[model samples]
Target: MMLEYLPLAVVAIVGVPLALAALTRRGDRALTRLALALFDGWVADRGRRQRERRELLYEVHLEDTYRMYASKTLLYAGLVALAGSVVGVYLAAGVLALFKISPETVRATLPQQLWFLADLLVFPDLSLGELFTLLAFSSATLGVAGGAITYWIRWENLSYRANARARQIDESIARTVAFFYALSRSGMAFPEIMRSLARNRSVYGETAEEVAVAVKSMDYAGLDMLSAIERLADRTPSQKFREFTDNLASVLQSGQSIPAYLDDQYERYREDAEAEQEAFLELLATLAEAYVSVFVVAPLLFITILVIMGLMAIGRTLPLLRVIAYFAVPLANVGFIIYLDSITESLRATREAREIDAAPGLLAGVRRTDDPDADRTGTERPAVEGSAVRSDGGERPAADSSAGLAFERLAAFERVRWLRDLLSNPARTLRENPVYVLYATVPLGVLSVVLRAWPHLVAGTLTVETLDDFVVQAALVVVGSFAVVQELHRRRIDAIEAAVPDFLDRLASVNEAGMSIVESLERVADTELGALDAEVERLRTDMAWGVEARTALYRLEDRIDAPVITRVTTLLGNAMHASSDLARVLRIAADEAQDTRRLKRKRRQEMVTYVVIIYLAFVVFLVIIGSLNSILIPSLPTGAAAPDTGGAISGGPLAGISEVDVEAYTLLFFHTALVQALFSGLVAGQMGETSVKNGAKHAAVMLAIAYAVFLLLP
Candidate 1:
């Protein structure tokens, strides 16, 4: 009977997802609509506490209402449970057909002790009641499992997003404070400064993201600035952000001097950011020691003891060592990498992108009042207004110039121009994102692996131990190339950022010397500002092409994508709108950049020692593994050469002596070193440079040593 419904099941399987996918083309809101239609009665209405809790949860990061987004999440969970139930039924049928247990057939060969077990599981025939019971049990079990999985995912995803934002906010808040403080100094109102920050989320990261919600509430919900600030405090996940906003709300509510408060906050947060970075560096040092002791020393001891136990025939432990070397160690290394990344999150820079104006571009239709060019072109008085008045009391827009169409064309090209430039020059593209190097390296690495591996496969000699050398070599090839290129990219950015403070100081000096911004740029462009000189020239070129100074600075930010650079550009760009004393703003930006660089340089110097310790620890780990494989194992007594004495020593221990598999132990040790090399390098990179990508060279060197040591081993 169920077989008759199988085709319908198949159709439902295909159609439901296809229908959902069709809804996606309408935008994300389409799902919200569909989910509400299906589940609004249950999900939309909630108790007061749930409404409040989920309101806080859904507002900031998700940018959606609890009613809509919650409904969508619940609906997805139910669909997954439904699908799981269908799968359970099908699996129940499969089990019944495949197992088809019978008591008599097993009873003759089975013991009386196991009779109850056979009787319990045996199904003489697939009766209706029996089928229904089995299907119901399986369906209930799996349906609950699926529902739990989806529910966990929903909460986990929300929490992860919240935590990520918290991290981003903590990392970028110092710079964000400086940004608004600069605005305040420029005589911009606090409300306008908040609006500016909201509009520039790309530059400020999660700080701006939080403020953007408040700006929206102000726009759409008719909330005052103080109300929005309070709401922001309530909604933010970061404790730091909450405290900052709470204080800001207090300042706004009280009738205090906002600029003075902001200036003090900016200086305080800058020092706090530095202090926090120092703490992070200390944490990295601690993690480095922990990694070495756990991954290096601990494994060395365990492998040594396991080899000794196998030699004495106390336990057959070759496979255990193999599992430790090949499976457990590498997995733990990856975990360490994730741990490094999470801990370093508070220290990393945010480089998120935000869009600015692309409308009514440089090609605006402005008919000059006394233009000789328009007169020569026979169009002396083309209406520059969006519309023109006609005698019939109807509006007649200019037929001669379509500024909107021109702006649209320019915007269309601007979107793809970066892609075109990337295609035109592959090197710059790779430099922009080192991961792109994998596009070329992966294929080459794979081909080399296949060439080496194909021979082993044909000879029926393929095994992990045999292929370890080849696989690690391929990893080295792939990872080494990426690391080299990644380092180059990092260094390029570093060199450019290093010059930023000097460049800003020089620009300030020139501005204070009475040159206009353009004149200052021309003046500074004549004297080299190191790697930044070229970028300043680019900015100058963009301005020469009639771009606004603010937009040109924004372009410079977009291109540089550095930490201090983003803050500086955002500060300069927004300050120009609110103040005439740009020289003061420039000096402030330069000081901020200089302080950030100073902190980073100190952190780098401190971590260099930890990085060296990691390398030395890794070497010590290898030497221990090497000594065990060579001297200790080779020196141990084999069962074949055990003393034939009837003494207590021989009777208790030597009597159980057995020959160890030296070949397997050596292979495991070799592979263990490789795994250590791979992850230790990543840890070292994270410690020294605050990036795992910087670890590639370290990993390559470790891998080379392991390969050479193993090749020379018996």
Candidate 2:
């Protein structure tokens, strides 16, 4: 009966909306007018009231908000309800079909007293199909009701996003204030400082986004700075932002010293930042202690208990331990790492933004074919000899070819040029983009494994041991090559950073002695500054060729791409534009850079102990697994008959363990050690250096040790 009516049910569900839509377009949209009338009478009141009470529609930047927006909102709500009802009917039917529910089964599943209540509520004397039909209808009604509630909740999300933005503004207030203070000290006008901060939206985050709005208003909307600022204060979600802007506007009106006001604000924010850092460190300490207790102590204790249970021939003991070691510990560690990263993320000093070319691909060695001269003409100018001839039947070698090379030469050059460039600077290229290492190592690793496994494949006797050996070798090759390249890049960056402070100090001294910034840079160009010497020469050459000192400094920042260098260069470069006397600022920037380096070193030193702790924990874990596999499991006696069925040692501690496989358990133990080594290395890197990339070195060490132990000791 249900199958016979299924086609009719589907048509009624689908055809009604499409028919209504068709009618709505007919008779000059009569159905649309009816919909609008229904919305005005029934739905408009609640939405209008909510919009006024919440101010959410305005916050979300919706225009002509109340009546028109309310009608649209209600229309969307109706559509959502329709979609949800249709989905709910199909979902309920599918569930009923899959589970085959009946009244008797429903009664058995329910309590005795609840069965009578269900029977009273139309379950009595109903067939299973009829009951399922009623259930589908009820589900559809609930889905429609849920859609209405969900529509209201979605509107509430606008307010939630507003509050989140408010919190982000609060978080970034210190750095924004610092940028203002630094620029003010260099004597840049207030408007220019605002524009500069606004331009660095990516570096300054939400604070820059808010400032960009005010800048837009000032520039495009014909508002003065004061008026635009006042508007910003009115519209911003953050109370702190409102207070700052309002106080700033008041100071501008009262004729107070603007620099003095900014300096005071910067000092206050700096103090708050220090307090927040202290609080964050306290929280980090608590989390570290918790990690030691939960992941370290709990997993070790559970594994030991599971091993004892396994000795007693307890079923499921090995599976439980495997789950805890392989899944639970790693997942918990990942969660802890994410938590630590969130709490430890503090505001950073704003840095200079690099200017990328309008079309970066044009600079990426891709040959351009869209030049008007080349496009209007059919072919490009040929550089290769014998590739072009004059149409007048005379050779014009001096004039050169107006058309490009023959297809053969172009294709030959294209093929070999890539290989030549790779061979020329392979180290630098691979260091810059380490993913290229996989292009070589992945195929090589797979080839190595395939070569070893080919004989086994031919014989149809590929054993687990042979496959494991191949996999281990492949893993070592891939990870080892990538780790070497990554470590080289990291060390190169570190050397550049170490040389930056001294280079800045020397430049400051020379410039203070009455030389121009260009002259000062030329003086320091040949100095022995480790990794920065060549970059300094490049800066000198850039200036000698008439690039502005500021632009040259920017180019240097781009070339190095270090955060500390970016901050220092941005500070000094901007100050140089405002005043020629940048020696004082340069010295300050140098000191700040050195201080930052010192802090990073201190943090690394403190976290090293924790890194060692993780390594030792992994070693202990491996030892326990090894002991269980080698010393304990093999010692258990295997009976010819079932040990629990009146065989040798029946009812002993080893009873029911007659089928345990020592070899399988040993393999599982070896793989568990390998996994723990990888996890512990990653954890160590994150804890010590605050970078999972830095953990590659630790992972390399741990993996090498594991592979050596399992391969050689056996």
Highest TM-score, which number? 1
Question: Model 1 segments beyond 4 Å from truth?
Answer: 1-168, 187-189, 238-240, 250-257, 350-433, 453-466, 637-659
Off by over 4 Å in 2: 1-173, 234-243, 292-422, 428-439, 526-531, 573-579, 584-588, 640-656, 661-664, 712-714
lDDT of each: 0.76, 0.68
C-alpha RMSD values across all candidates: 8.4, 9.8
lDDT of 2 by residue, 501-590 (tens): 899899889989999887888998878889987888887776666566766676677666566776676667557657776676676667
| Model 2, residue 490: C-alpha shift (Å) | 2.8
TM-score result, candidate 2: 0.69
Cand. 2 Cα-lDDT: 0.68
Per-model tally of clashing residue pairs: 0, 5
